[model samples]
Target: MPQPSVLIAGAGPSGLVLALVLLQNGVHVRIIDKERTHRIGSRAAGVMARTLELYAQLGVLNDILAVTSPFGPMASYDFGELVPKSKTAFLFEHQEPTPDIPYPNTEAVNQTKHEGVLREHLAKLGCTVELAAELRGFEQSAEGVMAKIMHTAEDGRQNEETATFEWLVGTDGAHSVVRKQLGLSFLGETRTEHVVGLGDIVVEEGLGMDVAHMWFINGKMILVRPDDVNNKMFSFLYRTSSAEKPLTREDFVEEFYRITGRRDVKFGEATWLSKYTPNIRMVDTMRKGRVFVAGDAAHCHTPTGGQGLNSSVQDAANLGWKLALVYKKLAPASLLDTYAEERMRVIAHMLGLTTALGDTNRANMGKKDFKMQHPDAMRMLGVNYRGSSIVCEEPGAAEGVDDPYMGGVGGRVQAAYRAPDASELVPAGKQDKTTRLFEMFSASRHTVLVFGGDAGTRAPVVKALEHFPATGVIHAVLVLGQGNATPSDAPSFATVLEDRAGHAYKGYDVDTGELAVVVVRPDGVVGVVASDAEGLERYFKKILIAA
Candidate 1:
């Protein structure tokens, strides 16, 4: 086979997303997994806000929303006595949406269904998952990777082929062959005593599907939440006693009845059942030469904060655009290094947070006043890449990071933060309706927004950007005041837009008559916040190559 631009091993969420995003950008990718069948289970059930935004860009968010609902309110009982409302899970109320942040709440969805939605969209994009194809081994050179993949036939025959690709990404799970072949260190801890038994069961009697129910008794915590499926279906996760033997579906049901002390809540049969030891492990590095590791291949933690799948999806989102740039030769290979640097810190922080939450779980096991609390940080909107070498911040600013670019360069804003979403952008020649900054971003290329500047200040910036040969990989947009018209001398290559409601300027932190330039990366991060044409040129010169 001819070498693809990229080869992806493991058709899980991370690998599938990486393939779809790359394919959307016109990059050829081959994605394969060792599993013979699609997954079936309720694993990793919380989808954070950041992942939702990325899903919107991928065009699958609405479909996912159609199949999911807000996490039902959590109800806890102590020996049949109901706990107070404050003690329920989700410690914080859902954050009200602001103009700058469209998605402020998490959606409750399982891993299996989420992957199914992603695969459906990938098929629509003309790509299919090659199942029963395992990555046996590989060797990497400066030019690319030669991988040996074993394909299993229906007749029980196996055929191995050696394929070459410019890049190889391992989105394989924790026990990843790619990570093992690369000899990367997955350093962390695992505790056999901390075991969680989970299952999907049909409720014989209707337990109000509007709320998640839980019981704490005799050193155990049992939780039940509604799934998207109808017919009073619920997914359960419970802690097994450290001294208890291996758990079975009958054990879970018996314990559930014993704790609640109620025969009214009954289970007919379990659709899925499994037991797992809680483990927290992460790769020291995400990339080595031309091969890379993402998702569980890179990090795995207890699902306390539901960060597993969300973090993995973000990892693919972060790496997808950078890989495409390198494949097109529009950016240098060093850009890939930022993938490790940026993701490592976030994963480390996530590990620490989830570990602490696991400790909370153990502590609250037998307590009468157990509170199932969720933290605000779990939403994952605060992650940023301010300290990265590629992120250029203006001088005399807050130094490391800024809160909102709407505050301007001098105002408080992080240079490498996720660019805030804004609305009321009128695309040129369209007057009937307005658009959004996210709609313009779309993750295909870098987006340059020139905010509230006169032609004198904006003209030179546009001209200088046109002079750069990297226009194919960088998109330029001019956001003028509601009354100001596009200057006749404006760069013909640039897209002229009107911020009629002033949300763009306000959200991006530029005052009327004051010139500001915000450069958004393909992954929708604010790359640089500059004040002039010279600053814009300087930012691009560091990341882009001549066309």
Candidate 2:
């Protein structure tokens, strides 16, 4: 059978990630960008820990970390006097890493560099972003979508082209043509009253590169932080009601002196500048038939919490694997609906959280109310889809209640929750190497963690799963307790691992003598939690199509 083809609109981080993931899953993809040149400046600065975990799975976390720095030790200034107390200015508080949670802190890098990392990875997969190409319109039917794209040549000649694809995805920014064309309502309010000037600039000297500097004077706030590129370059955001004329380099310099009450500060050049009016809007639904929208195309929110790019890229991750499965005929088309069902909930809560943070920021302009801004929820590790249609939990499981932002109430991994990563697992009687749970997941297969019970209870579950090939849709992993011998009757298709430190069992909350199966989706979300073979069969029935 021919591989399914997908067209991704917009070459931002979201579009590029979706394309890269689809290509890795053996899907054909064509990515396009409306902008003639790539985006620049420190637009979205915060890369959440959850996003870093996904990047690790995609094998681009190291590349991204190479270009970024850890965010910390923010300093505040009041009326030209440095505050005696130093406080962290990030949106989320830092947590110490545990055995299950690997990345516990957020990383800071400008969106421009972030997109560049994704673009390079996409190129490695034999795909490149087509620049100066615009998606004019599209119409989708039962089988596929007919898209009209316009390409502009260097000679200023424009040519129209038509293409057909099995699916269409829009990662285009806030003013997404795909969303508008589909007539999906971008519903929400625009905070014009809270306008600010945001951009990157070159400073010859004066500001400390080690810490973020914030000056709150005359009931206005101006923040300056070192650019991820280098110390000589910095990014600034100044809140002002009057930006009647376009904000220029002179305007930023002049405003900086006025707000800081210091004549010694110097500005070399303003490489980029723009006005930001917070727009809180999102589509009612992320998908309509064969055409879909992800990232900024699906939702837009205040940049207070820095959830924009992370949320959008996650949307791509959630949709990419599902599309690949449907095309490969391993899953039914109904599996696609769960993307909208799951992401919409997270996006809606994210919009509210960021909006609240923006409001708190505006309220604390000249006050010392920094405590109201940062919260654990902003870390995004707590975000879950407990109510997703495809998430199957064992009978009588707690199934914890769901909150819009905090997710379910559980200390351990639950259905539809982000799968916790456990490290230092050793093969039975093998001492040479250690393995992590995350290494078992791939874009092409589901990871099934089987917590072995007694020989009597474990054999049936393992034997029944033997019918499903581990190299195919399901990759079964037999996790044995410490000092337990590998059973001779263990399925040949399964990969056996001994939890040397007991971290896997404790992290996953598996009972000592009860059989349990934790099925993780391709995107690393907990898909199904079952205790028996019949329960696992029901989950596959819901997602996979019968041949």
Candidate 3:
């Protein structure tokens, strides 16, 4: 009998990522796509720093960054002249290193190219994206999820196969078959007033194709960024009405002229042109019993601020670990609800923001103040789970105090709270900080930041964890800043940094005197915040242990 596990539908960025994660953590996953063969379709160009951190955990970030470099800087254009380059210029990084936000800013590469990199990684994990197999129907039961997948064989044959798994995830694009099959309602609008676009073309030599250049030509906006991997191939984002229906190669040419104000532009060839009528909508619920939805299946919107693909990738990251726990029997399956509950807010927010940005396109606002908590800023990595059922109904939601990204809701103010004592987790007399621990912990899991001194005081926490390791509960980190050499019983060990001068602690915003801890889920969202190890333990029991 096949193992009861996850059934992931739609192999877009989110679905494919969910497959990679589950397989890595020992969960069996079968991913099916509606299309017969994967086509290098549209470009989902923007990748946020937090998403990059998730990719780093998946272990392909370095390779991804290497393949997509040397894209000139990000430039704003006034008329035909270039303004100052953007601070977030690095294709694969926002800022190299920052003590506040562990992740970098955001990165950009065509969706086709990015998807290719993901496919390569997925192949290495003993899973292949089964093309042509479409999820046409599914039945969810307490036992497992059985899906009817339709596919046409290479011999020009047609077949329907029923596959059974413990759970099903829909990652299909905007018009999701799984959503329709489940009778779920996608609540929102398909009101598109202007036409948005994307295409790959060659630019005039030394037009500074090295930098990601944006031109707000009159009211239409043009965003062009060179693919570091291929100089001849550059991705362009703009609005056009050159064609009443779908724009063509000539339309792209004319639009480029309209924006660049230079009809002298010539191109060698065209790779892809995709036109999307912005539909800002999200499913009423991301989860219904054993079936779940993600990515475009759960939420899609106008590509105005470029948050659709970023948010979808984030949804994948959030669900991957939780679903793994379900498969491992570490927690009751109900724990999976957190995926929908937590990610729904993200999707809803994106839809709201994108819709607003779409409305403002006629005015063509420049830059939109990256610092402002404008909905479009969600394009950066600032999602949270403060009001989540998994957040233990913590007291801070009203004032917006405790959730991760405490910097402020909608990413308003960054985590401005810094500790007075920079060396929070170092031994008193010994020059040891938890820098290595932070690096290693950040490498794999979104670490639990323990702040109170001598975490061993809460020995019962370790006992509880050891007692429930089979239950598949929360992963714990023992943070000790000022005092200790060892942990008595609990999983308490202060961060031991390479240099004890407190450089690393300062890097992550941990102060010696602050007696607080943050529960960071695998997807990098802060699940809970507490005063001490006991609070941390309470969070573990609440969110991690048996459903």
Candidate 4:
């Protein structure tokens, strides 16, 4: 029998990230792009601090981080040029909220730089981005999804081929072919006021080009970041003067002066300069049976606040784990539907925020004082879907209960939850205190989270753990108060660990008044936040063992 297939459309960062994440779990995927080559322009440059941490978790931290520039001590001025220097007048600073995870520094990485990182990562997974390929037709059934694709080779001959898989994903950008085939409606309005200009160019120095140089003037802006990967080239994003003017090489340079008060700067060779109407769009739906859409295919955030790339990458990460589980038959089909629901909800908020900020940019064109400084905007990087079916939120989970984003890497690795001795786990070779015990657990099997130390809770939890030993490998944990357990009494409570002074509960950042047990899914998300550990055994035996 042939292996399972995942047909991914679009080789942009999000699509490529999805393919790489899925491939890490040994899933077979074929990533396709309508463009014959990777885009080298600086389309999206703002990589959120949270996204950088995700990449670090994925094991590509050293490779990508080495080439990327550090964006700190940065400034955002109201009356001067927004250039990267040793010092600055305007401070558009972004800082990590929690010290445990400190890599939340977002530098200006162009789409080209990031795409190179993603492409390199994808290659390591034995998958290559297929260029000059387009999806023409596809169909889904109870069994799987079948895709009809057309490929054009170096010979320029177009060949039609068929790919059948249990699942198909549309990452094919705003004008997604996969989305169109699925008839998913892009439900949002296009903004009409300002024209967003983006291009790649090498400028003649002394216009103050020491660090990443940006000019915030004349109600317009230009972001010039260094891209050594492309021969020390600097990419730019400036606002177009009017909608009527067609963006050409000459127009792109002339407009920069008209806005920034500099006309003597000789702009070097040009790559791709696009003039967009700054539209915001999102699909009314993201999933249809075996077919799903992600990234711009799902929702197009206004590109002002830099949420588009990170948001898309987060969508891939959220859907990657679930898709891996369901594709492997470890979860029910209904669980796959949650991808659209969860991501659609997130992208909607991103779009709303980005649109509001874009309006702010258009409004502040004269003063040139456009700055995106929303703290809530950073929340997208750390989003988790406790509401999804695959996640079993505990009973009476508080309405609007903020989920502590924690997941184990299938081991005894500690989660960043507050531990009695957080100071002990600091320098374990790139390991931080944030590596929680939750992240160390293998999410492939439903792990039983036994909360309390009482006989009522421990008895049923132990029984279920033993019962599901073969059915589901259960990692029985005892989140007791500090000094609750001792080695001398180890045999009496064979699998119990002292709560470390109620530190585990506090560390995991969970409420621990009297909840007897909690069951965690393989993904380190709460599966069954048990009401009282009542019907607890049946939950394992009935809902889970059978579920």
Candidate 5:
């Protein structure tokens, strides 16, 4: 019943995710969608490793894993041939799980189911998406944002209501009303020459579910991928000429038969169907005043690397915690500006990457010898905010590194990088069992990790953190060396762990006996890497408001 602090104008995965992050941080939110019902389709189905790690932080990994499957190999067949001519290499190389990267592979799950899981989590947090409620317009002042929302009743009557909130986020797809109203220039190209018909359909038999079936016929490509574990449902993407009119289920069926020349496969009803033309566009900036944009609203590209939905979710994650801190008066409002600063560059790089992949895909449609391979960068674990203004790296740390998609598996541990997970840590009193660094991370606060130092050595760092609120905004974790005992003066609120197997030290690149401190932001990004309390204080000063 408390007035919502944030108004999110889309209920897709991006909006739902932002709402969940804010709710977890105790920030109330109102998420609205213009559609009467959630969309159904296998639109953006590839969930990458980086997204999986983020899902873990939000406590939705188990549910997501339940409904998703690993990316399967693409099996290409010659036209009119039932047998596959060749099995194209896996789009991404299979990497085994390591201590640093737990989720090493991409998973496949439709956008609809993905949104459902996120919505379920939001409901548990006591928030629901306001269906049939459309954000018509909004105006912002220095204090807050006043939004005009149009609500439709069951009988089709409509009423416009004015609502006030501290912040507004537009996650409302590519045709974002928020972006248009804000007058943000969406500068990019739309490739009308390339069009594809996409939909999910049920096939009773004559298709294997383990691999994606691909056929290049008459200078067009038809890619059919298994949609579910039941083996009866599948999703298809059919390349169509610009001359062709908008496609229906009947048209899709007719084309499928004509393109593949397969009569043995029995077709059932199509669950969803639509035409897709790569928009390949992005806003000049993700923010304008108190209102902001994320997901497809900010940038949209071809789904070549399966990065669209994942990048959108990442955009929400980056903005969510920053918004919460500013809303709670824990951090300065200027902190929200960093959202556009960090995400815009990354989205630009993503657009280029997907565009190149799409170009390659179109060019290689009929090339029998071409093999499709996605670069490891598509995993997104390598994505970093290396040059972010808020991140601080101490003297002698790696500097001048230009790679944004660096530092995932086997990469150096430094400031502004994704904080790698460390396992086999023994808690203060529990020698029989152990936990991981990820288990200690919370979406609600910044985690200050004090590594390899005893109580006397770490006392300065702990004392410095005392300047900030300890209840919900900041937490300290002391990771002692293998033989080091728990510090006698350790703060009651601090968690003490022993790096028995050195996994923590190795993952963090900290020497066994060297003392170090890593400040991890609420979004699981390493905010700062330092050797002393002064470094920790300086980083927090940039992030938290002075007490």
Candidate 6:
């Protein structure tokens, strides 16, 4: 077999996602993890809305939703109280699904099963994560990267090998060897004042599985939530000022009974136990030469808002398409620079949001204020890349908008925001069945939407798209306004559709009879919002290589 184009240093969600994206785009990838076996604990459990949308594009959302549970309410209790005081507080409130936003509520699934679903998808694609294969070191030049990989056998045998690939991505986590080799500054502070103990235990009985239980006694706190449907397994977090020594299952059991005053709630067994020290850190940049770092290796913060895994997955999604385009020679290497430019801004904003949530949790130690509801920003639907170096915007466009986390949806549709979904679109000359805009999106290609333009107005825009590769790379869709018939002169290369309910026009913020062009990138971000053919050509010029 030929050498892989990319070597991913971690097999966690971020690495798996990046590998899947590359393979979907017809790029070769080899993903590796240092562990001897797949992980088994409920590390990160919350899956946000934006992540679910991305999974839908990857064709794994159904499997994920099939096994996961919706984010439920939390039952709060005071010191030594067997009965709960309140049961209305929620980590994330459920929102009704709108035409534009399909998965409006957060879902809960442990990291083990979540990774299992992703690996299953990868297996169907003829790729698997190489266990026990660790990236020890790597050196990158202008052309490719030379990596040293350490492989450990099951019986304690170890061997080192050298390999070469076009690019190396580090998703090896916070203590990443790849990041340290690159000498990037991980600038941040470690919170030493508090330490958290996390683990999974089997509860015999007496706790309901529908709600997460939280207990506050004197100045101590412990939160436990059901992990499986059987209500036998649960995940808990105990926060304290200090733990001079490592904690055992006995210690956790003793503390649980002491805090909750519920000795009747017997404990069976402990599945896993670990300590967590809150560290707020991020790298200045994500790339250097042919090497790049993403996910936890790039940034890590408190897991208060369930943004760590979601942000990591988003980072992979943002970089995967650009890397594929560059690898295939369809786009210039400069296109890869925008990956860092776009994601770093979003990561900075996310770190602040999660840190604030952590501070609030710390401040409300003994109070009855544990009824926390995550802000809408946690959904991440409004994160935008307005004013990006590669995005093109028409005059009077909302460029450099300050609302990074809560703009674009139900607001003016801008150039670099998340593209909203539109339904009730009928193919030209057919009204039997309708399709949604999201159904036409794919991770391997770009979607160009021409909204409500006359034949003469659309001819030039359609002609501009001919400059790029047409086979599985760039797809053009012509969306006509309501009550407008498809013109005979419509371009044969484009898919012509009629908006029967005007959802396409309304969701995109385009007026009827308006001549506008919107380019959705492979990652479902609005890359360009243009008024005419000149704007379209100018935008693609920055992305595609010159003929």
Give a tens-digit lDDT track for model 6, residues 382-425.
88786678887556555444666766635766788888888889
TM-score between model 2 and native: 0.94
**Per TM-score, what order, best first?**
5, 6, 2, 1, 3, 4
**lDDT (tens digit, per residue) of candidate 4 on 74-133:** 233333343332344222355643423445466666678678988898787678888998
Which lDDT tens digits does candidate 1 get at residues 176-261?
99999889998989877778888788887746677787777777678888885566678898876553566567888788878776
TM-score of 3: 0.82
For each candidate in turn, give its C-alpha RMSD to the true structure in angstroms: 3.0, 2.3, 5.0, 5.9, 1.9, 1.8
User: How many backbone clashes are present in model 4?
Assistant: 34
RMSD over all Cα atoms, model 5:
1.9
Q: Per-residue lDDT tens digits of candidate 2, residues 1-547?
A: 3443999999988898899889888888999998888989888888988898888888899999988888766777766664424565654566788888889788889888899999999898888899999999998999899999999998889999998999999888889999999999998998878788999988786676778888766677888888854548888998867656788888888878888876667778887899987889999998899889999888988878779988988999999999998987777888899889999998988988888877876777677545437676767888787667787864544355557466445686778778898899997657788998888877667888888676677676666676553447788888888878777755543588888889999999987578888888888888887888777776777777752
TM-score of each: 0.92, 0.94, 0.82, 0.78, 0.96, 0.96
lDDT of 5 by residue, 206-296 (tens): 8888899888766777889999856488999887766357678888888888889887888887999889888889999888779999999
Model 4: which ten-residue window has the lowest total lDDT? 418-427
Find the number of clashing residue pairs for candidate 6: 0
Better of 2 and 5 by lDDT: 5
- Go through the candidates in order and give each one's C-alpha lDDT: 0.80, 0.82, 0.63, 0.62, 0.86, 0.86
Candidate 4 has what TM-score?
0.78
State the TM-score for model 5: 0.96
Estimate candidate 2's alpha-carbon lDDT, on a 0 to 1 scale. 0.82
